[model samples]
Target: MVKTSKTVGRCEEFTANDVEVLGKAPLYQGFFSMVKYRFRHRLFAGGWSEPVDREMFERGHAAAMLPYDPVRDCVVMIEQFRVGAYAAGCAPWQLEIVAGIIEPEEVSEEVVRREAVEEAGLEVGELHKITRYLSSSGGCSETLDVFVGIADSRKADGIHGLPEEGEDIRVRGLSREQAYQWVESGKIENAASIIALQWLQLNYRKLQEAAQDLPLP
Candidate 1:
């Protein structure tokens, strides 16, 4: 077993720089093609290195919002079908937080708010930045910016989605207790939703107290 160390010095002679792909091996062919690519890279730490030609898949950033209504003590989530899961021989449909890819000209918060409206048909107010991290760092370059959004989650009417985009999202509202139960019951399966809900559970009291101190809108 490799022992973990926090204070390990950087290796000068043996350095691993960013890996780059030169070509790809075809994996799947559908609406979107999935491929594994060949790569060439360079390593530089104490000294400079030459550029190595490589190939990689084009990827985008995504955003997810955990809609929470402080007054109502409820949360809103969306359900959708994930193609990647189906390809991996798992459940294709998944319950997830409101999320979308970040457009080239759009900001992260804007992406989250737009996704909330598109996926759930809800207008969000102030947004609390939760965390930003890579979703699957192994093969994908997609990163996720997650936020806890303030909204009237209790007022969610029903499922809402954009037909033009082939989206058939189902919007659902759940009380804090219900959300927690779903997490425990294995109903909430998506990573972002699970992480956001768990974070909310841990910080619920502090957030509630903070919300109480805010002025009425």
Candidate 2:
């Protein structure tokens, strides 16, 4: 008897044709768009299943950066009123990493840099990619690109954010160790913040060695 490997490992196995979009109608259209979709997808066991109708909330793609100061061993965080938290009976004002939505034709680095200044008043230099994930696939269509940007947290203090945009953000710098404590204590509830801090905890030495070769900004 001969042992053979039968693992299917090609993207061609799954394509847009695999899922049939029967119809889609706009349920709401404002700053964001929501749509009702009637579709059918091929099952992993075999062929297509019955048509399923569901509503999807679309907010497009967004990018978020967690600004860090490897030299200072610190991180810059911001606090702002979050409607989602308020609606969920959590604190409206929650601590989070500096982040913003990527505009049309804008790249990940550009969005995070802009957001860093707007949210934390800190200028981010080099960026290390962390992770990209969907905030919630079941309902919202929000894809987030998370990064850890190198910055000088020594002077990252005071309030920031554009008043016209209804943003009132408070910038606060925390030691790397303290930031991790916040994560362990549930003080840092945002996914982007928690992930970035833990990543820094594990990769701080790598960042430090890389920083030594570059000119300080």
Q: Could you say which candidate leads in lDDT?
A: 2
**What's model 2's overall lDDT?**
0.85
TM-score of each model, paired residue for residue: 0.76, 0.91
Q: Which 10-residue window of candidate 1 scores lowest in summed lDDT? A: 1-10
Against the true structure, whose TM-score is highest? 2
Local accuracy of candidate 1 as per-residue lDDT tens digits, 106-141: 998999888888889888887888898887776667
Q: Model 2: what TM-score? A: 0.91
Point out the worst 10-residue segment of candidate 2 by lDDT: 1-10
The true-versus-predicted C-alpha distance at residue 187 of model 1, in Å, is 1.9
Candidate 2 residue-wise lDDT, 1-217, digit = tens: 2122244444326556567788999999998899999988866776668999999999988888888788888888999999989998887999999888878999988999899988888878899999999888998889899898889888788989999999999998988889899999998888778888888889999998999987545
Q: lDDT per model, in order?
A: 0.76, 0.85
